[model samples]
Target: MIRFERVSVRYEGTERPTLSGVDLTVPEGELVLLVGPSGVGKSTLLGTVSGLVPHFTGGLLSGRVTVGGRDTRTHKPRELADLVGTVGQDPLAHFVTDTVEDELAYGMESLGLAPDVMRRRVEETLDLLGLAELRDRPIATLSGGQRQRVAIGSVLTPHPKVLVLDEPTSALDPAAAEEVLAVLQRLVHDLGTTVLMAEHRLERVVQYADQVVLLPAPGAPPVMGPPAEVMRVSPVRPPVAELGLLAGWDPLPLSVRDARRGAGGLRERLADASPPEAASVPEPAAPPEASAMPGAPAPVVAARPRTGRFARLLGRGAVARAAPVADPVTRVDGLGVRRGRVEALRRVTLTVAPGETVALMGRNGAGKSTLLGALVGMIEPTAGSVRVGGLAPARTDPRAMVRRVGLVPQEPRDLLYADTVAAECAAADRDAGAAEGTCRALVSELLPGVGDDTHPRDLSEGQRLALALALVLTGRPPLLLLDEPTRGLDYAAKARLVGVLRGLAAEGHAIVLATHDVELAAELAHRVVILADGEVVADGPTGRVVVSSPAFAPQTAKILAPQEWLTVSQVRGALEAGA
Candidate 1:
């Protein structure tokens, strides 16, 4: 359905082509997954099919690209709208209407479809994506994940033969992500629609791919084959694949079921051994001397028990301490936030203590983002109270709030305004009153090799996120809140972020992040709080909450449980000790 013939794309400013000599083809009715590290042209490759690369993006296209036998060079995006439907990473950027129903019909209306046809297709799409209940809701009021589903539904309503999705499930919770993927599966299997998608969260979608396309590096020829074949050498891999590699399995398993089926011997070997000890929380970093930073509040110290160096290094100190009963860095009581007629958050209450990391999780529109907004003063509570470091967030001055708390929203662009990365970092350093190069140093640590002169808008989603996170951390806020923090980060970047957050938590900084990435929660969170219908439904230690709920469990937990294991690293640690 889609074909590329030695296609190469080079933007106006740079010398090296983003994609070089990429000759590939996607047969009709097939679901092809584009996999690669950040900045490796996955987005560039997807754009070629929809004619956004050389057309809207103003790039040089060296070879022919066609969809359904019509060369993209001869057809612009609008002219080929009937043949291809594209959804970019940012859903808000794709909307042209205020409400869900209108957004779904906008594409069809642009194509000049008859009103009857457009109406029928709009309803069908809403039902297919499970958005029928939200049909009349305003687009601006939807959560990040809801906006994602709406964006996809808008494209699917057009019934284009070929669907191009960039990070389709990046913003969705696990269950919602499964729903979207299942819908795509039906389109490919039952309706014979061709799908080409690129996503950073491989564990969520890798198993569903009919074929895998790996863009290993810029200017390198692309690798195409079955999912397992590409994953064997791909730098980024799902946890199941990583486990398979570690266990020396002949054929790597892409899904949890397959991994479990092949793990009989390993499980038997582990049956006699006790599960590896959970890491102990590290000692909270000593507070800065009162004279060092005048007027700064003293850090809240946790009375943690002694732990080993490894536990301290991993920031697992929470495991060694008794239940925390006091000194909450953030407290919410009967918090309720309303937007117009919708009750976004209702009587939601939670607490985060110093040196602890809490992951707030729920389905899309489950009030996770709303709670984060309330914590950072972006959304005011209408019927309850919110406190960060003893000050009401909604009423705190912006300058003082920066020291007490910092929030990195789902869209990193909202925090960035400077033209260049260097300038942004400089501004952050100056505003935070930190050392001149502190922000840049944090950026280099979070995202190495990003050029100082690069524009903030030009960085990939993951890189941009890293920059935003660095900007927030420069202040060393006592309490940190991040919404969908791992949207575009690859595994290596995620690991680095985990380490950074671990260090911060060890230093008595409370970290609260809203995320759909269960793997991240399993790795970094001391506690898991599940929100549903704008209220906390489950709250407990990470292992307890995630393992009991199938929808929230990570791949490793699903495979290794009934055993309480949550990560491959934990399994590896146990095996190493036994060996």
Candidate 2:
């Protein structure tokens, strides 16, 4: 139903084309996935199908693109709106209405559908996406994951023949992501709707795709095939696929179950090996160096605090947290928060010590981000106390708090304000009271390719995250908080972040990460804290906490059951040791 004939796109500023000779066809009633490294033009490629490329973005387009038998070059986005529905990376940018119900119906109303039809579709969507309970909530009030579902529901109500989604599940929790992917499955299987989506979290969505299109690198022609075939040559891959490659499986397994089914020999091979140890505090490093390539800047978007849905699924596995720490960097005791009538948090307590890493995990509205908000002084607790560096975070001075704690909120754009990457780095250095090149050095280490002149808005999801992290690290606060840190990062970018965080932990910094990325938790978090509906239901060591619940365990743990292995790196380490 979608065709690209020798298509290539180039934005005005860049030296290389965003897309080059991208010839491919997406069949009707099939779900096609776009996979690649960050800034490989996956988002730009999706824009062409909806005719938003040359028409709205002002990028030069050279190839013929057609959707539903209509030429996108001739038919502008507005003209093709009825035939195509798009949900970009940012959900807030997609909304045109205030409330969930209104947002869902807005698209249908634009198409001039009957009121009854719009209402019917709206109700169905709310139910399908588990948004029925939040129907009356304002778009401004929903979590990032919640807004993402609402955005998807809005486009879905229009019942377009094609759905072009960019990072559709990036903000969603595992359960919520599954629900969204299931909804897409139903749309493709039952309604004959076609879906073209690009997501960095392949572990969450790769198994569901009918076909995979890989953009190997920047400006490279895309490689297309069955999911497993493309994953073999693709640098971007899910943990299961990576595991399969390591095991020399004939066809790379796309799902955990597939790998698990063929793992008897592998399980025996790892029967006596132990998992790699988690990050430990390191000695202080020497002072910052002089020069390095510039890092990144990002768009402003704290307006949409990302929410996740896996909170409900979190209950599938639960354990109590570790013993309280003495002289903690931050502490929360029986904290409670209310957003209007919603009890966002209730009687929750968590503490992080110097040189420790803790992962705050739960589903959307599970109070993970809510707890982070309370710690960062963004949300005031109604019932309990929050102390950071011996000061009440909500009442502490902003300048004073900078030394106590720093937060890279779910929206990476929240901490960024400069026009260019270099400017952002310079500003970070000034605000943090650090050396001139402190922030830039860190940014370059985490993100190597971002140019100094690149605009924050022009950055890819991973690039923005790396930039935000660099900004926060510049402050050198005693405590650091990250909400969904890996939301937009690929495997390589994520590894770099892991290295950075591990180093920070080594440097006696306390880290609290609120995330839905199980693999990340497995790799970095020494402790896992699971919150469910505003309360801590599970807390313990990462290996113990994750293994207690089947749903929360990482891919390696699932495949190497009963052995308590949580990451492929652990298995790889063991194999290398034995070798």
Candidate 3:
């Protein structure tokens, strides 16, 4: 029920248009997916249907966009609220009420719905989205994934005919993502609701799409067709599609079930072979400017980390014999954290050695973020102790803690304040007490094409994440913590980040990141630690941990089955080695 007629959008400052000559008609009661790399106008196009393009964002729109026979150009976002419901990238900005129950009811109140009708719809949405337990919780106190559900539930309560979602599952854990996607499926199938969604994580949503619209590049018109047809020509792809292409399958698979059904011959070919040893994090790359600066302290070049499978083997001795320091970089002992009436973490104990990479994984609100906060001195544990480099994180001075540990939270914007990228880098350098150009050089390495003049807010979510990571790494902290680190990054950007993080581990920095991307955990993490309900459920080598669990396994691991292959890289390595 959405139509775009020769639409093109251009902002005031730049010469190139964000979207060029895009013409498409979204059929009623179908789910349409918008796929592309970052900054390719996917978000801008979604804005057009909700009357946010020219009406709210102040951009020039050359063509017409209509939703359900109503012209978006003439009807502003407020006027069209009855027909459309939109949930943007950041859920915090979309919130107007304090509590979950209040937020869900506010939309219907504004539409002048009767009290009884609003109450019924609110209860249905709460049960459908699994937010009944959190109906009374404050929006500010919920985790990132929880906030995302509340935002979606708020829009859903109004019962609008058309729904527009941007990265709906990016912040959610695997099971939680599945629940939200299943709800969307019901709306599309049973209720005949129309949905248009833009997301970077194709692995989670591609198989559910009725039609796929691809924006191949900047200033390029979109290609529309079935999911498989468009994915063959698209530059970016999910792990299942990547594996299908690698195995020379006639038709690429979009889901694990499809890939497994055709993986018999490929698994036989690999039965005699073994997956490649997981390499240690690559040596950290030093900024050229920092090395050349006069009077700057020389960067420490630590020994390369232990070889294979993990930083060290999963059992017995995990710390390398050649490690520079005898003490662990960070330690948590019987940790317990309480937020209001909920126990966020309890009796959680873990340790990270020099040059080790660990991934914390679990469902939404599983205490992963709470553990990171304890390490970074942001939260005080109600019970137990937290130590970073022999100093208590909660008791240490702010300046001293910066050198010991650095954390990049789920909201990357919290760490950003400067107007321009250059200014942000300069401030990071100063805060880290490092060379003037240190942060910028790291930014250049992580995000190659980003300009210095670009505002942090102007950049897409992925670009903003890259810059925030660079800023945090500038300090050269002994321990680093990242929460949902790959929230907005595409595959290419994620590869670059993996390379950079590997190098840091090689330079003897301890890495602890909380994430939901199974592929990332398989590719980069030396060890996987699973948490559930504020307790560690499973912790071991990457292969053993992921291969045993269906929800936690990557596409490659799922397809290659009882053979224990975790990623496509390992499979390719076996093939190249004559297996």
lDDT of each residue in 6-125, candidate 3, tens digit only:
999998866689899999999999999999987888889989999999888887998899999999999999988999999999999989999999999999999999999999999999
Q: Which runs of model 1 end up more than 4 angstroms from their true locations?
A: 275-324
Q: Best candidate per TM-score, number?
A: 2
> lDDT (0-100) at residue 31 of candidate 1?
95
TM-scores for the candidates? 0.92, 0.92, 0.91
Number of clashing pairs per prediction, in order? 6, 14, 5
Worst 10 residues of 2 by lDDT: 293-302
Clashing pairs in 1: 280-316, 280-317, 281-316, 281-317, 281-318, 282-317
lDDT of each: 0.86, 0.85, 0.86
Q: Predictions ranked by lDDT, top down?
A: 3, 1, 2
lDDT tens per residue, model 1, 176-289: 899999999999999999999999999999999999999998778899999999999999999999989988887899999899999877777677666554445443443443
lDDT of model 1 at residue 140? 88
Which of 2 and 3 is the better model by lDDT?
A: 3
Those runs of model 2 whose alpha carbons end farther than 4 Å from true positions after fitting are 280-320
